[model samples]
Target: MTNPLGIVGAGIGGLTLACALEQQNIPFTLYEQAESFEALGYGIQVSPNVVRVLAALGLTEKLEAIAHRCYGFELRSFTSDQTLIKWQLPKNQLYYQCRRADLHQLLFDGLRDKSKLNFATRLTGYSQTTDKVALKFEHAPKVEVAGLVGADGVGSPTRRQLMLDSQQTKPSYAGYAAFRAILPWRSPYEELAGRATVWLGKNHHVVAYPNGNLNHGEQWLNLVLVVKESQWQEEGWTIEVDKSQVAAEFQNQSRLLNQILKDMIASPEPCYKWGLFTRPALPFWSQNKVTLLGDAAHPMVPFQAQGAAMSIEDAYVLAQCLQRHQTTEGAFQQYENLRYQRATRMQITSRKNADIFHASGLKAIARDFVFKIVDAIAPNLMNLKSAWIYDYDVTKL
Candidate 1:
């Protein structure tokens, strides 16, 4: 009998890839290090591009049940809280704001065969031969795989071993930190429901949107505060922090900002802060029978809000390539070729947005002025600008 394909890391990318592979009737096993899936308490944007892929996987109704469909996006000023640009999102294509854990759960439950999922299985290393790859584990016996996919996220062991030359390089800090929290949806912020909002400030910005718990029938708001920070150098998204650490950074700010921050702090939910970091692009993502996917291949700053979306797209494309090609090397090569340019573009653009969103002094004034003019002349152009990204359909690829 033919050996099954093996996938490492059961993140959004890994789970989505498993679903896609199942649709193609490809045999595979998914390995996850965590003993069980934990609920992540952050909001994730699911743009139309990724919604296309999820819908293809028979998750449309399930997604609608858990996610809030965003009708538009508004950008406001930090000091005045005045709207700089407001545009309705594309009606034909659906955009959603949902809790990361809810979406993760939906994807996990979407799989046709739960038996293929192996939790508490940590991959230590892997060795590849011409015909198959052997995956090493810390506790269990090694498993031979016909083809190996490293969906392991940032600081991936697979990437480290694959790129012997680049092993010495570390992830460069993006000179910023992000604080994420969730609060109950209330009257003062009732206008924020069914829409996404951003308050752009000097060297900082805030994003807030409506998300809810479907199981409990409760309404909630998700908040993310990003600010310039060069002193602290910690990484990872789950680092608990006192709200004072965030409040201290925004002294003498507008009342609107203060109220939101206060709401975030008063919430019973835990608050998390993590430094933003980006890694240098890999020269190649594939080597022989093995290749990387999602943050494993390219970890980017979150300014563009496309980090998860790109992973979802990558999952579908990689699975299609694997099914289309006969040899594992050919499949890996084609997957990298198809995804490298698009993923790199997202990484670079996300980095540039950090500066754009945090523009201050004359740059900030000029940026707001341009937004006003564009908002007056042609608001649709603002939405059209992202057409390339939202209009993409990976299932068709």
Candidate 2:
């Protein structure tokens, strides 16, 4: 307990782990490569499962104050221009769509001592022993700790280093990329602000929802346009786009979809883009006192919308086991045992959704027919899938 636990990456998973450890009075240090945290990215949905963890950390009040509570989730058809299906969100205890930075800040400020965070100190290398481990960074001297965690994200250096002892690994691209726009929420768009809508098409889908935290006082609809691609050579989370180029891609879809895309294009903001990536479930999640968390363990395509939620779940469960088990190995083993099956299932489900969402020809026809019948017979059938995800409370793990 004397040596502070070393955590690499200050992302949602890393931040959540740090906060959970602090709540349990465990000393820890969080390292981030970024010089300073900036507000980037678009809307993120904090579903019921994740909110339970935040509520445990005493962040419910702050979170509810900033995020928009989701009223319902509707999936619409782009070809037919009709509502394919809908699920009414539970009363007041529904899902929330918060700006990514807003949630990060909530966890960031929850730390008791700001000095515990070391920014601009990237992980360069690491070595471990039975007693403790040493962490090397790009900008500073090495530090040793009882345990080391890789919450750095998909390209986690900690994961790569651990992989040296086992199977070689790398993040694989999904041959598709997403373009995002924060359209100004005003006048005509005002009425659609709070609803979470998904427009399903032949080879793509669009997810749109309003977030009130774009500019100082302005509101904006966060639209994510996901389409198939041949190749992407981008290096970062966002990129510049020729408005006409984006428009041309979606011109074949519905008129409503086109109008929304056009308005988003007219906005002054440059479109943010990132390639969707996927990876096989790791052979394992732990090696000695070093282990993985979040995307580092199981990176998946974003079809399930559980990327962040699963990470939040991992953070809580990891901290819980680490607090109880006497040895780091036992703690990590239990953590994986509790999570591996469920996490793998989620990856499979999310990946399968891509095929379903992007269906064409005979596949698309059968998919629509099945959905129509389900909507007629059991309207709430699709909503039940959420209980497996949203109903989980990691604090009780």
TM values, all candidates: 0.95, 0.95
Worst 10 residues of 2 by lDDT: 211-220
- Residues 344-395, candidate 2, lDDT per residue (tens digit)? 8899998999988888999988888887788778867776767788777888
Best by TM-score: 1
Question: What TM-score does model 1 achieve against the real structure?
Answer: 0.95
User: lDDT per model, in order?
Assistant: 0.85, 0.82
Clashing pairs in 1: none
For model 1, residues 203-232, the per-residue Cα lDDT tens digits are 889898988543346667888889998856
Which 10 consecutive positions of candidate 1 have the poorest summed lDDT? 211-220
Off by over 4 Å in 1: 165-169, 213-216, 235-237, 251-255
